[model samples]
Target: MTSSLSWRLAFCFTLWLSQPLSLQAQETLADWRDVPVAQLEQGAQNGVADAQYALGLRLEKGRGLLQNFALAATWFTRAADQGHAAAQHRLGQYYFDGIGVETNAQAALNWLRKAAQAGDATYLYDLARVLETQPEGKPLAADLYQQAADLGHQEAAVSLAVLYQNGTGVAQDFARALQLYEGPAAAGQARAQNNLGLLYVRGNGVQQDYVRAAALFQAAADQGLALAMGNLATMYENGFGVPLDEALAVELHQLAARKNSAKTGNLHPGWVFDTRLAPPDSSAEALERLRQGVTRGDPLAGFLLGWHHLQKTETSQEEFRQAARLLRSSAEAGYPPAMANLGLMYFEGRALPQDYVLGYMWLVLAASAGQPEAPELAVVLSARMTQSQLVEAQELAVIKGGDQLANR
Candidate 1:
């Protein structure tokens, strides 16, 4: 069973166990009684789309029968063929998740597009999620999100707001983002509530209202949004809109930390999966993929590999040297993170002598390329440079001294 299924079953089991001992079996049996398999099967055979979809659900969930994903997928396909929007969505989701069908992102996108065109808000949002991971698909995804949001899909509103907030495939319009978030936030969308709170804190697209921010954070935190928990904790610590309770802040921070991962809106080159492949599942597999990417002359993969090696806890001297070499290759290919990290390592004398001039030059190039951390590093490193050193660094940064530094 999938982890989601396992979690659901565990929750149901706990709920049943908490009830009166005499009623446990009775209630459990009753839950599946309403779904009569025989009649559903007969109706499905008669080509009734609704009946086929319902039967598919029952089979998928093992309601009054054995769980059979293969049969479930067949029934969903039949219903989907008959223009059942929900069935199309479910079939696509199954394909995407590799539940009953092979994990085929292309097929999933095809089915989801069909469902979205059928005027279903839910499927529209689902299609947008997959498209968001595609190269050159974000703009189309944004359009789908807008459509779904117009139909009052709260989650779609939140997703659209995130694109606007980040300028991903759209102009960065925090005011429009704030406007998009307000409806979903009011509708109890946790991510939207959290993002709206962020705008309030930053005074972006809205007046800085700490109290409003706190309230929104609290609302999202109540729904288990870990980021919002952290935000609320900050408010408590700073006494912005809450009592200054360091202990409470610590507790909330711990809760936030325990969440492990979240859906942050930033997209990266690794997410540009237009080939309909699943992500690698193991470290070796990931490394092999990166190696292949590097073979294809992808600078992003080289940069990632360099960063990965640098982050190893027990990395050896040779490993650090390899890391620098890899970063150098990536930086030469114009990878900004590679340039920034390479510059930092050079400045700190890691696997190389402290070359502040070269470091400053690399950082300047990285900053120009819009690497997020490079500007701050450049400011600090440039402060230590003499006027002549700064001039030399600036001159070297813009010059195409391609093989000169590599030879040295």
Candidate 2:
């Protein structure tokens, strides 16, 4: 089962309760509640580390008991004294997060080190995160991350790989990153799989292996990793990984476009291939295709139609309105491109009254969704508007109802 913070704490408490030798074997929640708080205190006094830890958690969470941070800290200290790995980790987190404890980096590190030494992968990962943020030299952070990665911490592996790839905390070694990603990726880590695929696709750190790259991307895409889906779609369209299959390419692109739109609530612009891939009568065919897709509830199709309208030299008011409606719908659906496009329309007062606030908001959303061109577009739009207007646009962008408006 996936463990939430509460559940993890509960598990630690349960472990503590089970540690005392004198405690009855068949203890239940009822038994725990029936036991006088003083008797529980006596169990801790008897050097029952587990009891101490459980009593501490009960105090910390006020679970069937009173909330007392001081008591909780005392009990955790008792358990920590007994070398309880879970309690140590919990204490570390408490200190690190300043939850029921004074924030102390050194104290957190001390407890985390104990947990890490006891083979707690999660603690190791947390320790790495803390170390990485320290103003100290990069070598220490990289070493800590590597320790966590070696323990099969997936995020740590990905982080370490990225660091190596970019030479952040270590020397730039694309090969090392690729190697690191390979193991975790094979174990079904989505981010690792995505990175490995990218490496293969780019012929970086390894021989060009489009086939492997496509395979890895497919694995990640199957797990609903959106970026992987986009990359895979590109591979299909370009025949990089498999034979050129236009139908398959279109299908994958549609999936990527749909996911991208849904995730960001805006329609992404469709891929515009070079002149070589252009249809003989692309203008008519594209328009017809866009219409068909829109009829079928495809937001991407609507966005593409809007783009066509905007690009038209002899654009009509009707065209602009249609484009606005479609782009708005796609943007509401979290399509970054559509958000950016809609922002552009509002910024320029193309089809509607100029609304800087709404425009800025959409551009911000687009940028947040990792649109590479959003920043440049935002700068250009901001240049044409006043500071107050830009600020207002940002405020309006956060008002979430693009979906409802688009559906209308």
Off by over 4 Å in 1: 1-35, 257-408
Clashing pairs in 1: none
Residue 267, model 1, lDDT: 14
The window of 10 residues in a row where model 2 has the poorest summed lDDT is 5-14
Q: Each candidate: what lDDT?
A: 0.71, 0.66
238-331 per-residue lDDT for model 2 (tens digits) = 7776776767767776886777554432432332212322332346776788788888978777666777777677889998898889888877
lDDT of 1 by residue, 1-408 (tens): 111100000000111101221122233234333656787778789988777877776655444433345677899899989887777877887777565667788998888898878666767877898888779999999999999888877878888888898899899999999999998889888888888888888888999998998999999999987778887888887788777787898999888876522222111112111123343333988888988988898877877777677767777888788878878888888776777888877776778787888887787676666665665455445545554565566567647334434643
Residue 60 in candidate 1, Cα distance off native in Å: 1.6
TM-score of each: 0.54, 0.45
lDDT value for model 2: 0.66
